[model samples]
Target: MTADDRRVARYAAAAIALSVAEAALPSPLPGIKPGLANIIVLVVLARHGWRDAAWVSLLRVLAGSLAIGQFLAPGFFLALAGAVCSLAVLALAQALPVRWFGPVTASVLAAFAHIGGQILLARAWLVPHDGVFYLLPLFATAALVFGTINGLIAARLLALPQGKATS
Candidate 1:
């Protein structure tokens, strides 16, 4: 396989792994996750570009769901929706000047979009009540906290020494 293909595979695997790992963690609320897999997506976005990032992100949702036995279920749809929304936000985020906008900004925006997508989906089909909106502040806070942390992690990875090995 080509180098980019290999890189995409590697990144996607890592993202899927993270997704599965996080799935085992206990969350006080349903549908609230740190989205740790997004760190890989941000890294791919920087090391490669948005397209590769999309592949990694989508693969994580698809493969991770299957691995967790949630494929084609409600959880799968929620994850797919979140990933799609986050990717759309990231696409537009790339247009911003790099000097001002970087991984952290992109992460925060994408995180918010991720949770926003989930909330909207939950409101529309799952819950179908205005009551779902009541959780906005909580989810938003989680997004901010997790997004910033994941972005910082990606930034650190981007700064690592290239002498380790060739891509």
Candidate 2:
């Protein structure tokens, strides 16, 4: 593969791996996930640019749901919407002169947007009982914790030389 294609493939693999890992992780709150795949998304965005990262995120979510047997579930649609919204946030962040915010800020914004979309989708489709509202705080908490960790990891990875050997 060409260099860019190889890079994208690598990102996609990472995202898919993380997505499956995240899905396999036990969650106290149903439909809530740590968004571990986002670490790869942030890394791709920082290194390859937003377009490539967005594609990775999209593919990851789609393939992830299929793997987890939730391909056509409301949760899958929520995830897809969340991924799209998160990418939009990332793209907008890239345009701003907010270098000081760094990947951490972008991650937080993207994470929040991702959860927000899921919340809206859940409220619209399955949780007509308004119980979905109760999960917002949990989602927010998970997003902040996971987003910060993912952001820091991405930041550190970006600092290393390209294709550096990892233990």
Candidate 3:
């Protein structure tokens, strides 16, 4: 494989590992997750670019679902939708000035987009009722809290010495 391919694979592996680990945890809320794997995507976006970050994110969702035996399930679709929306938002956010809007802003926005996409998909396919919208506040709040934490972690990782393999 090419160097770039290897790097993407490594990043995706890391993300998948985190995803699997998160899956092992018992969440108090059904759809609420720490989304720690996203920190890898944010770091990849900052260091490599949006395309590489997208690869990492997509690969994580696919491989992670398979690893957790959730492929083609409702959880898989939710994850896929979230990744798509997160990547789209990250692409748009990349156009902003890096000086003012950096990894933290990108991470937070992407997190919200991810959750929003999942909610929409759930409402359309999983729940098929207006009642699903009632969970928006809880999901939104979780997104904000987890997104900020993930963003801070990504920003710190980005700020680390260049010797690390993340770049």
Candidate 4:
């Protein structure tokens, strides 16, 4: 494999591991998660670029779903949807000035988009009921909390000397 391929794989592996670990945690709410793996994506975005970060995020969703035995399940669809939304937002956010926008801002925007996509998908495919919208407040709140935390962590990690290591 090429060097870039190896690098992407390593990042994907790390993200998948974090995803699995997050899966094991007991969440107070069904759809709420800390999304710790996203920190890797944000870091990759800042250090490398958006394309590399997209690879990492997409691979994480695929490999993580397979590892967690959630492949082709509703959970997998939700995850895929969220990743798609997050990546899209990140891509758009990339156009902003780097000095004014950073990992924390990107993370927050992506997190909200991720949750919004999941809710929309769930309402259309999984629940098919309007009542699912009622859960928006809870999910939105969780997204804000976790997104900010993950963003801050990414920002802090980006500040560290070792954090800049690509390998």
- The candidate 4 region of ten consecutive residues with least summed lDDT is 158-167
lDDT of each: 0.91, 0.83, 0.93, 0.93
- Give the Å shift of residue 75 in candidate 3: 0.2
Candidate 2 structure lDDT: 0.83
Question: Cα RMSDs of all predictions?
Answer: 1.3, 2.5, 0.9, 1.3
Ranking by TM-score: 3, 4, 1, 2
Query: For candidate 4, what is the lDDT?
Result: 0.93
What tens-digit string does per-residue lDDT give for candidate 2 at 7-120? 677778789888887887888887667788898898888877888898789989888888888898877898998999899989989976755778888888899999988888
lDDT of 3 by residue, 1-167 (tens): 88899999999999999999999999988889999999999999988999999999999999999999999998999999999999999999999998898778998899899999999999899999999889999999999999999999999988889665645
Output the TM-score of candidate 2: 0.90
Runs of candidate 4 exceeding 4 Å displacement = 162-167
Give the least accurate 10-residue stretch of model 3, judged by summed lDDT.
158-167
Query: Which lDDT value does model 4 have at 55?
Result: 97
User: Compared to the true structure, candidate 1 yields what TM-score?
Assistant: 0.95
lDDT of 1: 0.91
Q: Per-residue lDDT for 9-89 in model 4, tens only?
A: 888999999999999999888889999999999988988899999999999999999999999999999999999999999
Would you estimate the TM-scores of all the predictions?
0.95, 0.90, 0.97, 0.96
lDDT of 3 at 18: 99
Residue clash pairs of candidate 4: none
